[model samples]
Target: MPEENYDFMMPNVNFFGPGVVKKVGERAKMLNMKKVLIVTDTFLRDLDNGPVKQAESSLLKADIAYVIFSGVEPNPKIRNVKEGKKAYIDNHCDSIITIGGGSAHDCGKGIGIVLSNGDDLPALAGIETLENPLPPLMAINTTAGTASEITRHTVITNEKTHLKFVVVSWRNVPLVSFNDPLLMLDIPTALTAATGMDALTHCVESYVSVNRNPITDAQAIQGIKLISKYLRRAVANGHDVEARTNMAYASILAGMAFNNADLGYVHAMAHQLGGQYDAPHGVCCAVLMPTVEKWNIISNPERFSDIAELLGENIAGLSVMEAADKSVEAMIRISEDVGIPTNIKSLGALPEDFDKMAENALKDGNAFSNPRIGNKEDIINLYQQAYKA
Candidate 1:
């Protein structure tokens, strides 16, 4: 076995709590940003009361002006970043304040990187490819999943190519990360569940990734434990602050883990679905989790067995292999309880597209970390299984 070690990347500053959303302006001032590009989706920006409202109040209090670019879509695209960058340049914005989930943060990251380096977004598509520092960016996460607010990795969907390219660079990690559970209280139950499952996927995938380390293992295990305990409760009742808070913390933990340990095939395939049909990223992850892990368990039965126990599977009389099988079973139960759609056919992805999707998935940066090294045939099989699941 190859020795596992990693150099972790983290946000410059982190703030967590119910009212931390009101502190964005203070942090913006600390970063000496005069004007900011406020990147968010139309839904958030249009909310009468939410993170966007709270952020605006804070920015006004701190005397920091901003330009709102509210065109970011559900599965954010390269065009969204380009438009945001245009808004930033035209409005003379000095920095960025990203609000919402991964879509908003990923769009802001692309804009910030392009703004600073003067390079095309496609040019910075790979690991550490950025040559210049990105403009200061602070991310306020309204959802308890994605963790795009803190991670050094950004996923930008190319409109023309239909590929969600992974951009890894420490320079693009948020200068400040804020997670306020109160912002998540109003989210619909389905969304809460989907996002929670996404966080769970991060922990599970990173725990068995090729880059897993002692530090990542500690975080991933704890994150799995937290998600297993609270995900159902949170989905059952969005008003449960305690469940929301725990999931938020778990998201951060998983983000910390995967930021260094990286992800696996689940994300690679999920990204392809997201890029192809603009499907909800978390829902895709939730639907694919069990199918991918069943095949993946053979790579590291011990780790998968641990995941089974962490997810509340009883393993008193089972072998590690049997317990590992329990992990996939547990994921399926949770998916049903949380209302993660069993089939992804709604996304218009068909069996015929599996081969092409698999070809693209094999090239994803996340695939390199998968415990099981697979070819296009293996990926196609996973896709077929997930589609019918």
Candidate 2:
């Protein structure tokens, strides 16, 4: 076999700890950003004493002008991107500061893409479609999932087609990313569980991806171990500083893994459900993860076995195939422990729509790196299995 070359990408700089969001203004100033657009969801924008407010205070202290664009919706849509771009243009903002989770970060990236390139969001769906450099973007993460803050990929939904497409480019990576655990201390229990599971899915899919290399494998393994140890703690007590800090690190580690090595069918299929149902992205990924991985275990049993152990499964004395099966069981167990929905059907996904969703999943950028090259039928079967699981 020949050696394969791979590329690893992440934000140029990352800050992690408590209250590190205070650096946002100073960082923007250092970047020579005159006026900035703050992209976030309405809830965060209005939350008292929230990270958004902390960021605003920082920007004010640095004498930077900013306009808030709080139209970011869950599973960020094309219209959200368009609205954010308009806000940036209207406010004459020179940079972007995305506050919140993946939706806000993804919407900011989309807005930057259109501002630098063209307005055809759908036309920019494939990998590296970006020809021009994006504006200076800073991501302040308030949640411990998605890792969109550090990743070079953004998932955006096209309202017209009702499909979520990924745009992958090193240019999409933020200039800086902040992962302050304090911001995550107030996240709801359900959200914490969903995001933790999402991070775990990233680790698993990237570890088994055909594109996986030593670097990504190490990150994915570490992320899986951390999520297994701390996710439940964080969900049980949102204010658990230790759990929140570790989960934040886990999220970024998984981001670094998948942002480079890429992801598999779990993310590919989950994106379809998000686009169609406007369902929570993390929850969709959590529900579909085990089913997809069950199908993928045949592609790389050793990797699945590794995941089984990393997820704290007792795989000792088991055959390779048996240990790999443990990985699937562990995933299901974690989802159940975290109170995630038992099946996609509970999340409002319709079996009748599985055909189109599977078709779209095949075309997702993440699908190319999937360990198993599943056909449309294979994807539909996995969806059905998850529907009943």
**Whose TM-score is greatest here?**
2
Clashes of each: 1, 0
- The list of candidate 1 runs beyond 4 A from truth reads 1-5
TM-score of each candidate structure, all chains considered together:
0.97, 0.98
Clashes of 1: 1
lDDT of each: 0.90, 0.92
> In model 2, which range of ten residues has the least summed lDDT?
1-10
Predicted candidate 1 versus true structure: per-residue lDDT over 1-389, tens digit per residue:
53554477888789998899989999999999999889999889999888898899999999999889999988778788888888998999889999999889999998888887764777677788888888888999999889999998889988897778888889989989999999999889878988999999999999999888889899999999999999999998999999999999999999999898999999999999888877889998998889999999999999999999999999999999999999999999998999888877866788877887899888888999999999999999889888877
Residue 68 displacement (Å), model 2: 0.8
Residue-wise C-alpha lDDT for candidate 2, range 1-389, written one tens digit per residue: 11287667888889989989999988999999999999999899999999999999999999999999999998888999988988898888899999999999999999999999899988888898999999999999999989999999888998888889988999999999999999999999999999998999999988988888889889999999999999999999999999999999999999999898889889999999999998999999999998899999898899899999998999989999999999999999999999999899999999999999999999999898898888999999999999998
RMSD of every candidate to native, in Å, equals 1.3, 1.1
